[model samples]
Target: MKKLIPIFILCVLSCQSIDTPEEPETVLEEELMIDILTDIAFIRAAKTSSRKVFDEKGINPESYILRKYGVDSIVFAENNAWYGGQLERYKEMFTVVKSNIEVSKIKFEKLKKEEDSIKKVQDSIKKATGDKKDDKKDKKNKKNKKEELEIDDAKNRAIEEEMEKARVKRFNNLSGKE
Candidate 1:
């Protein structure tokens, strides 16, 4: 009976499967670093632009980090904290992002200047053509001005006549004449 009991115990132990831990899910260092840095960039932008803009744009940073990088908040926070503790690495990553932004800004400014120059050229061309139209318009303007002057002269004459009549009536009234 004791031998049967020992064999039964051995059989039961052998039947139980040992779970070998899954090879620690290997995380790509580069990808993880990029995601952490991107989150930092998003945070900086959010600080300046405000949460209202994000909400209006329907961009939730938390969800964005998850959806884009497949990292949940906990993982992201862990990466952020780890990278943040590494000052040199954090600065290196920050510098890269800042330089990229500066390059884009320079490109945008150059394009803006080019656009402005083109607009100025177009405006000059329009003004040059507009001068010819203005010559014809000047004739109409002169006629309108002359008409306005004539109307003003008539108005003045009527006003002067009314003043004279009023003055004479005041003189008659003062002398006891109707």
Candidate 2:
């Protein structure tokens, strides 16, 4: 019985050791939270700047602000953080800013394409409808004008649809739904 008791105690200790799981290495949640907060703050600042430029100056604010501050200067300042924690925070903010610029560039490209298409349509319509009119020429001109008007109307509808799609896409991307 004494030998059996020693064997049972040994088995129990072995089972306990075998079944115990190792704890995962600690991650600093606070640091992660702070980085996320910094990124959010940077995005908010960019949105505010964009609104200010659009509302007050009738222009996109990003290039204006970048020019005002000097991109190189801002980059240099961000790179030279005095403390390690601050360096991480600055890096996070920089990433956010870069992402914002990338999204803005995509939107600008879409707008430019739409603008070019509208201009081309407008020029064609002008040329078609601006011809000199007299008798036979006047009848032909009226028919051409009607066709031009229909084309213009179609172009306007297309532009409006594209603009709406772009607006929805932008909103979705900004809201993190995309």
Predicted structure with the largest lDDT when compared to the true one:
1
Model 2 per-residue lDDT at 5: 98
Per-residue alpha-carbon lDDT of model 1 for 1-178, expressed as tens digits?
9889999999889878644333223333654666556666757676577977876787666666566666766665566566665678768877776776677679989999999999999999999989978987999999999999999999999999999999999999999999
Angstrom error at residue 5, model 1: 63
What candidate 1 gets wrong by more than 4 Å, as runs, is 1-74, 136-178
State in Å the error of residue 83, model 2. 8.8
Please provide, for model 2 over 1-178, each residue's C-alpha lDDT reduced to its tens digit, 9 standing for 90 to 100.
9999999999999887743222223322434434433444555576786776556766644445445444443342333332223556547756765676667679989999999999999988877676533456889888999999999999999999999999999999999988
Q: What is the Cα-based TM-score of model 1?
A: 0.45
Best by TM-score: 1
Steric clash pairs (candidate 2): none
Query: Each candidate's TM vs. the true structure?
Result: 0.45, 0.31
